[model samples]
Target: MTDEHRSGCPINLSLEVFGDKWSLLILRDMIFGAQRHFRDLQKGSQEGIASNILASRLKHLVELGMLTKRPDPAHKQKAIYSLTEASIQLVPVMAALGSWGLRWQPASEELSIRAQLLEEGGPELWNRFMAELRDEHLGIPAEPSADGKLVRERLQEAYLAVLAERGKSLPSKA
Candidate 1:
C-alpha cells in the first residue's frame, strides 16, 4: 500500500508515522526503554512484539525520518539506531501516555519507574528533556561542545543510570 496520507493537519501528518500500536511502542522503547537496537527492544516487553513486526517498525520509522541507523562500534551484527528530531519530539507524547498508564492502568506497581516518570518528570520534565534532545539532535540554539555528548549518548547514559539505580547493570555489550 502506498503511504498517501493527509497532510492537512499536523496531527494527521504525525499519525501517518506513529498511528499504530507497534510504531509508538517501538518509539517508546527507544525513548523510555533505552532500546537502540533490535535485541534491546525484543527482550524487555512482556507482550512480546514479534520479530517481524519489530523489524518492520524499525524500517518504517527510519524511512519516515524518525530514526537513523548507525553501525554499532561495539558489535559486528548490531546497528545502533538513534532517534532523530522527529522521534525525539515525541517525548511529550510518550510522557503523557506514560502518565495515563500510571494513573488508570492496573499494572502500575509492576512498572519500573512509574513514580519518577509520573511525578518527578511529567510534562514539564518531558519538555526539558526534549529541549536537551533537540539541542543535541537538531542543533537547536546550539550549545558549546563542552562534553562531546550527543542527545543519543546522553539518553543512553541516563538510561544506564536508571538501570543502575534499580540494581541492574546495563546489559553487557556484545
Candidate 2:
C-alpha cells in the first residue's frame, strides 16, 4: 500500500512492510515485552534504537496496518501503540526466526530463553500466546484452560531465573 511493488511475490511484499531490522525489533518488543509506550520501546530496546529511527518505524508500521497508535489516557502527551491482528499472526514467524537465531547466532541465555521455550512448545504454545495477545490488545477473553502460565509471564520468569542464577537483579518491569 505504501508503493507499487516490483513483483507480486508475497515474501517481497512482506519485506517491503517489515523486512528491516528496526521494524521487526519494534514488533518483538511489543509482542514479547509488552512495551506500548514510545519511551518504553526506545529505552527497553536491547539494541538501543535511536529516537528518530524508532519514530520512523512506528510511523511506518502504523501506515502498513501492522500497528495502531492512540493517545495514552494516563499521559496526555504520550501515545500508546498496539499490535493489529495482522501483526499478532506473526508470532510463529518470530518464533521461527528466534529458533534460527538460537541455532546460528550467538545469543545470551536470558535473551534467547523465550525462543528456546517457543521452539520446545511448538504450535500449541503459539496459539495460546496469540490468544493472550488478543486478550491484552483487543480486549478479548483468553481461552479458558488449565494451563496457568501465560507465554509472556513464562518468558519473563525464564529471564528472571537466568538473571538470578547469575546473581543479577531482575530489571524493573517497564
lDDT string for model 1 (74-100, tens) is 998999888898788777677667666
Candidate 2 minimal-lDDT segment of 10 residues: 1-10
TM-score of 2: 0.93
lDDT per residue as tens, model 2, 32-56: 9999999999989988899999999
- Per-candidate local distance difference test: 0.70, 0.92
What TM-score do all the candidates reach, one by one? Answer: 0.68, 0.93
Residue 130 in model 1: lDDT: 71
Q: Which residue window of length 10 is worst by lDDT in model 1? A: 108-117
User: In model 2, what lDDT does residue 84 have?
Assistant: 92
